[model samples]
Target: MDLINFWLENLPTMIDGLIVSLQVTGAALVVGIPLGLLLALGVQAKTKAVRFSSMAFVEIGRGAPALIMLQFAYFGLPQAGISLSSFAAAAVALAWTTSAYTSEIIRAGLEAVPHGQQEAAVAVGFTRIDALRFIIVPQGLRVAAPALLGFSILMLQATSLCFAIALPELLSQAYMIGTNTFQYLPILLFAGLLYASICVPATIAVSLLERSLSKHSA
Candidate 1:
């Protein structure tokens, strides 16, 4: 009853934070997924310069911590007087981070397609671009779905950065409630459970997607 009452009292704040977290995650996915596919394709280009540059970008983004990226987006942009909302900052940072991972997944998926399939498409009068668009990406996405969704779960976790920039997110809200109620442990535990609740469904969805792909491949 105490735990229930505590949660009920803090529900509004927590819900607000959850909304922000979801917004960051959702916005990042909306923008980053397609950009990630393009980056993967660019990284595989025949031209050494294009490929190398794309790979370099991916490596740099992936290697850096998401918190560092959030800090950069939050502080670095202001020096140029190009300030963004915390939501914008969070979205950009999360998307940038996710794009790097997604690019790798996409690259691997593309590679997983048998070389013979590409050759067959070429023999059937399909241009490289057309073949890639029609035959390759469809198959590649199936291979990549599990990884992509897994990355999204990661990105969702990463959205915890909203606190640093003063944007209320789930963790931030929990922190606020804990600060007020002096029940830090319980608040944090509840917050963690909420995050896990969201992640579990996503993880299950990815597993199901992988199974569906495997069935199709078989």
Candidate 2:
């Protein structure tokens, strides 16, 4: 009951932090998903150079942990005469991770489009770009929708890691409250519940979307 009371009292401050988290996540997704689509296409490029470069980008992004990336963006980059604010660094790091992983998700969807679809487009006088734009991409994105939504939920959860760089996101705010009150256990528990508050409903929505898509496909 005390924990409940604490959560209620702190909810407003935590909500502000949650808003910052959402902003970071939105920045990541806006930049990342489109880049992911490009990477997916790049990997399939006719030029080996482009393909290899895209592949390398994906490997590096996927290989590094996001925490390290955030640290590097915030701390390490300053040594190189580059600097980003906490929000910028968090957004950039998360976007890199999102793009790397989502590239594969999108690539899988793109590949699932029947080869005949391309052929059909070609037969209809569509260029490769046109085919992808008007046909392949739309269909592929629909197929990928559920997974992308689920990944978005994970992305929101991932924002917690931004606490390491002092982004003042939800987790960071919770940590701040804990430090101030010296009630780390209860405050953190409330923070975890706050995360669950967002993620649990999102997960359910994703599942329902998946089932609806499945039924339509069937």
Candidate 3:
């Protein structure tokens, strides 16, 4: 009963924090996915410099831990005279991670497209850019959608890493409440439930979408 009362009192605050978490995830996905697509194309570029630079970025982003990236953004940047608020730091760091990982996913999707399709497009007098825009990119993105959605869910969960930087996300809010009330287990459990609530449904949806896409392609 006391725990219920505590939850009732803190629900509003928790919801606010969750909203921030969602906003951060949404912002990262919006910016990161497009950047990912560009990096995917760059990875396939014929120019040596562009390909090497893109490869370096993708490797570094995938190699570094997300937590380290968060710390670098929030703590390390100030040493170089670039300062950002906690939210901005968290968003940028997570977006960088998202872009790197998703680039590989997108690249795989692009490669999955048959070479014959490109040949067909060219034989039809389509320019390379036009073929990519009309024939390749759309199909590739569709094939990649399920994986991208799964990654987005992972990115949402990754928002918890922002707590280290004192972003007022769900985990941070729960930690603050735990500190005040000394009810660490219950508060943390509630926060876990909150994350599960979103992730569970998202996982199911992604699975369904994956199956559907597979069947459609088959």
Model 1 scores what on Cα lDDT? Answer: 0.88
lDDT of 3 by residue, 35-136 (tens): 999999999999999999999989988999999999999999999999999999998999999999999999999989999989999999999999999999
Pairing residues by index, what is the TM-score of model 3? Answer: 0.96
Per-residue lDDT tens digits for candidate 1, residues 1-218, read 99888888887888888888888999999888887898899898999999998888788789999899898898889999989888888888888888888998998999998888899999999998899999999889888889888988988888987788887899999998898889998888888888998999989988988898899893
Give Cα-based local distance difference scores for all models: 0.88, 0.92, 0.93
Candidate 1 Cα deviation (angstroms), residue 39: 0.9
After superposing all C-alphas onto the true structure, candidate 2 shows an RMSD in angstroms of 1.2
Per-candidate RMSD vs. true structure? 1.3, 1.2, 1.1
The all-Cα superposition gives candidate 3 an RMSD in Å to the true structure of 1.1
How do the predictions measure up, each by TM-score?
Answer: 0.95, 0.96, 0.96
Clashing residue pairs in candidate 3 are none
Best by lDDT, which number? 3
Q: Across residues 1-218, which tens digit of lDDT does each residue of candidate 2 receive?
A: 88789889898989989899889999999999999999999999999999999999999999999889899999998899988999999999999999998999999999988888899999999988999999999889878999999899999999999999999999999999998999899888888888899899999999999888878762
Clashes of each: 0, 0, 0
Candidate 1 runs further than 4 Å off: none
